[model samples]
Target: MLRTLTRQSPLFTSSVRGFKTSAAAFVKAGDSVPSLTLHENSPGNTVDLAEETKTGKYVIIGVPGAYSPACSASHVPGYISRGGELAAKGVDGVFVVAVNDSFVTKAWGAELTQGKDSKVPVRFIADHAGDFATKWDVLFDASKFFGNKRSKRYAAVVENGKVQNAWIEPDSTGLDVSTAEKVVGQL
Candidate 1:
């Protein structure tokens, strides 16, 4: 009787079993960056990534979160220190994206550009709802560590609204594949 009931249950139906769906494919070379508005300080002050990259060569660096050890120490600093060199290589902008609120993102940017007298060109923007990363298929299930969805570590070089190149880390949390140095080298 138990076996029969289990088989008859709606939850155990074949339709339910076959309901699994694959995630969207990650962004690739030649794909246009999604038109998503990310926040710089608050929702009022927004940065439209697709619009920003429409006419320029830009690098988008995605991180799990702001103030995280890997991000604060090595990941972001790598780009921060090499901003000039990257610009010299013809990269017009370098954007750092995180799945945090705008306030945290702004504060973090302030900390990174403390003594530069506003010369640092890196724009640290907030993907408040993790929407931008999700659209690019770079959102990772970071519930265990971040308590919510977070972006995978990756970088994409975009030119005139399309991706020129993409470097995504094998492991979402790993630091090797998508570091600024490596991406810049590839550029």
Candidate 2:
């Protein structure tokens, strides 16, 4: 029974079967962000990226998963700590996106925002189905560790729905290029 259920799971099925695409198709500077609805705490409470970025500058941080070591310890913290600095640079909001369920993402947000009076307005977004990551062409097979597809670590500065700058980590899981300090400096 367990074997049957495991085989039927989407992650198992997709990873086992496989999909292919051109690596050159990833989002880049000058490209308009794809329209998608990401969930914050629940699917009912959705954030529409197209509408959100229609007016001001937004920094989108894409991570492989929520609560991962690098993501929890450094990536998200850097952005949270530098939220004021980023805001001063004309950023309207910093969105941390991860390929996890809304519940997990929300819990992670709470963990990061704990004890903060006026918490850094960073939004934690859940790309549960990987639709947003797929559209951005940042979705990569992470089945070995995560059992499903995950986003390549990256950061993008969007102005009025179009990308003004993009920094994708050379090694999808590295913390070099997509760090908050590096991305904010590019902004």
Best by TM-score: 1
Residues forming the 10-long window of minimal summed lDDT in candidate 1? 112-121
Model 2: per-residue Cα lDDT at residue 45:
92
Model 1 whole-model lDDT (C-alpha atoms): 0.88
Write the residue-wise lDDT of candidate 1 on 1-187 in tens digits: 9899988898767754466688658888989988987899887998889998899898899999999999999998888888877887888888899999999999998998777532237899999999999988899899999999999999999999999988888789899988888988998
- Per-residue CA lDDT of candidate 2, range 134-154, in tens? 998899999997999999999
Find the candidate with the highest lDDT and give its number.
Answer: 1
Off by over 4 Å in 2: 1-23, 117-120
Question: How many collisions per candidate?
Answer: 0, 0
Clashing pairs for model 1 are none
